[model samples]
Target: MTIQEIVDKILAYHPDIGDRRTCDVIVGADPNRECTGILISIAPTVPIIRKAIEIGANFIFVHEPTFFSGYDDECEWLEGNDVYEEKLALLVDNGITVYRDHDHIHAHRPDGIFHYMMKHLGWLEYLKPQARGWEVVLPPTRLGDLIAHVKERMGLEHIRYIGDPDAIVS
Candidate 1:
């Protein structure tokens, strides 16, 4: 499919005509298109943007802002923001197409990201994935073992903590 076809598919999945100012359905490139290698990312950063170029990715689907912050704020476009500027420049210069799947991907019953994470972590059968998060049906295990398992499975350096590390989290 071409760019137009891809865009149509996306809209078909999530038909909400949202405000452009919101990042809900921002397309850094064209919407309707088919690309050779599509780049999927959770956020758009300088490295991620360049990585797309290095990989010769014609289509990019990013989860976060390439220029702005927050959910829907019109991105700050001033030149003072060096990092953001560089990222945008790469896209413009290379004619890369970028799309954010925030609104559409989450529309799936379990959300694409949830299923992706679940599958990657080998927890699909044990968890009900949702757009917001997930629920896991797990057998009994030691708290320390559980923590270590989660940390290793997620490859997380530091997970958010409401209390001390030694505090048992359920």
Candidate 2:
């Protein structure tokens, strides 16, 4: 299927976002091009783009902006910038289409990002619906241990925290 078709299919699963403008858009290459493979990521950094090329992926589905801006479509300020130009050139030359699924994914029922994050952290069962948002109630544990758990679950080398490591938390 074409990149645009795949993007449309994803949007179809989201709740009606009304007529308000959204950040979800094609930020690079041609959406009409047939997709050979897809690379799903949090952001389309230069390294990620290179990895996509190496994997022979013609389409990249990202949850964040491709350009260094809140709205990826606004590129007037990025003109003449070396980094922006290089990234754009990489996408264009490699024929890699980059699509951001930001707003729509957040608008999805149960919230697409948070739901998956909770599931990945094994905290979905601890989720409690609050008036304004959801909360996760974990068993009491030391802050250091919780941080280590998060790092292991997310496969991160390091993480930053601003509290006493020995402090108990839930």
Query: Candidate 1 — which residues are off by over 4 angstroms?
Result: 14-22, 27-36, 71-73, 76-80, 125-133, 156-170
* Model 1 per-residue lDDT tens digits across residues 49-78: 788889988777777755665552365555
Candidate 2 colliding pairs: none
Per-prediction backbone clash count: 8, 0
Global lDDT of each candidate: 0.66, 0.89
User: What's model 1's overall lDDT?
Assistant: 0.66
The pairs that clash in candidate 1 are: 2-33, 2-34, 3-32, 3-33, 3-34, 4-32, 4-33, 29-98
TM-score of each: 0.69, 0.93
Which digits, one per residue and each the tens of the lDDT, describe model 2 over residues 100-169?
A: 9898878865788888888999888787765123567888999999999999999999998999999999
